[model samples]
Target: MAFKENYDSGETELKSKTSQDSPIHCSIDEDHPCDDGLPPIDGGRHAWLFLLASAMLEALVWGYAFSFGIFQKYYSTHEPFQGSNNIAAIGTCAMVGIAYLIAPLPIIGMILLPQIARWVSTIGVILMCVSLALSSFSTSVTHLILSQGIGFGVGGSLAYTPSILFMSEWFVKRKGLAFGVVWSGSGLSGVLFPLAIEWLLDRYGVPTTLRISSVGLFLLSIPFLYFHRPRIPVSHAVVQRRLNFRFLYSKVFLIYQIGNTVQALGFFLPTIYLPTYASQMGVNELLSSLTVILFNVTSVFGSIIIGFLSDRYHVTTCLLITTAGSVISVFFIWGFSSNLWSLYVFCIVYGLLAGGYSSTWSSIAHEVQHANPATDFSVIFPFMETGRGIGNVVSGPLSEALLKADGWQSHAWGTYGSRYGTIVLWTGITALIGGIAVMARYLKCV
Candidate 1:
């Protein structure tokens, strides 16, 4: 392929090989244009703008989902939805589960119908915003599940999938850092959104809060979507590669995926149950919400730092660090928490470790790519998400079962003596099992 330079913009365009020419544009530095005439790989103004927009969009979409604990708390205590069985399913299983489960579909669609990628995302934003508005009129839990849960989940996957594809194209060397920044957007929102949602729910009630949030999300999402687009020009003539499944057979990929699934199985427990647990301990609503705030705040920094390290270290090594920290926090700090201060400490430590785990997906992708150069890194991410999604879908019913069981009672002080003792023990066990890849690394299986 030959490059055509446009003097007006100082960008080099890649000429299409097909009969219908589609030019791919990239900024070329005047003094130091590379021999390939392609845009800078790791850093550029356009790249940064794309990253910023993607991150903000991620924050807006995920921020609300992560703050579902507040809603869970509110629903448990109030109104027609109050005392509803399996309320956790509304957030964890139905909404987030469906989101993760269907994540690959849009990515596949983008690959097969590249021209419609942006349109899909645009439609997604509208669907997501409208779902919230629709949910405001819910008179039953099933209505909330259909609208807020399934509808919102579908929209989010469509809107966000493009960013995932473009992100891989934008940054090669610092892919981990880029993903970290984008993923941290959720953590950043996690910090503020919980407080904001709690305040809104308390003052305005559920119906008004949902309607207001719907309007706010639609307005905020438009500008960001404008920047979130394909790095490569997409047209009908661009020959799409056949989807490959060879990487699924790779030992390294399997090990990492197993750990990912195991980790996710228990990772969300604290987020879903911590506020309720605190309330059960006689803490006020504001203080209970504070636990979620601390968790999210620490996770923001954790995602960035973990991502930065993954760029420099082995992916398994990074997993080991997160696993160790998560295990310690769940077993020691959270297990013994008798008051606000201890629970607060647990959230900070656990959030910093566990919340940042997904940022390492870039490292996992790079690892898979290194092992199988023909593999599409973009394709690998959604499968990893699928692994986590399996856990997300199962966690609600699983936690409910554990809570209802009669055994595992303890006389010890703190959470060990509480009904959540089994949950605490299981969380720690899963965190430890999540480090299975590290064992595989030492055994030379990876």
Candidate 2:
């Protein structure tokens, strides 16, 4: 069987292959026979163990970043960092933003240097520990940003991008569910880590919390790297093809990218501001933290369900479902809340819908790859993440600006005061606009 690339259409088609030939084989595996054979694609003892380890890695890297809400609350109220305007929020956003922003570098490296690509995750683990340890010595927010935000982001991108590529090789028919399971690790850790971090922050202070977390991450992550190995033996004989830029011109890619960016702009605001918003409502610290916990816990179920849906349904349909639910929750539940229960309800609904939206990336990747097999999963995945990173990076500044708009205050309206009214409105509007991709699909523009 031979593969042919249609440059004009940006699609790759297999030429003269029998009906029994599988298109799902890795490009590398297609060129070279496997002498030391591996387990089947979707299921096997080794394959499941690899998935478990990947999930653990996901928990350790992304879980810490997602739980930054606890740290944000601490930094805002505690000494030394207290009264700083949006500094804590900036740090958290920077960490997550940079992780998404730099995602493409590892993929490029994997393509250019397959031998060295295998070691990237190990290097990431060491860098993460070192960055955390260095962060413990920070005397100011700037220092924290440099050490925790920038350092963790770089380390995490290096560590996590490999898993994205590896996952493509591991699962075929159930790829969406596999990604959901892997991603739910962050949600699972998000549920538990907030309370634990809150306890540490209360008892030990910022420096001690940083030091302890660094050590714990090192211990939890090092063992997992061993299991993060590739299933397909990479073949050096296959000449490294020049990066395909045709996807950049595709209508479908642009439509999905736009929706992804719009959704991300508002998706992170709730997690970043929920604790502070609850505090303004006179909620206690532990309970305020509980909102985030609830969001993350419910998000676990949301990701899996959405992933299953993506596998069976069109990606556009899944996007519409998520966008509608998120927009409704923000407008109806969060926007009108007067007490803790309403906020809790908003958390559950938003987490269930918006939280799993990223899980749809697997389906989106499939859509892209189905069109252009020459485009590697590494490249396609990172491009989508980069779109979200734009929203993530801008969201910090955008959120601060919205919160500062006192003129939007409505005295008669509940939770529509100067503090949160603009934010709630902004979140809902962006979520609604994020469904533009679905509209584009209906219009046949994509």
Count of clashing residue pairs in every prediction: 0, 0
Q: Please give the CA lDDT of all the candidate structures.
A: 0.83, 0.81
lDDT score, candidate 2, position 64? 87
* Model 2 residue 81 lDDT score: 85
Summing lDDT over every window of 10 consecutive residues in candidate 2, give the lowest-scoring window: 15-24
lDDT of 2 at 328: 92
Model 1, 10-91: lDDT tens digits are 4322222222221123322223223354445568877888898889888888888888999999988899988788888888
lDDT of 2 by residue, 265-342 (tens): 888888888888888778788999989999999998989999999989999899899999999999988988988899
TM-score per prediction, in order, is: 0.90, 0.91
Clashing residue pairs in candidate 1 are none
Residue 226 lDDT (model 1): 83
- Best-matching candidate per TM-score: 2
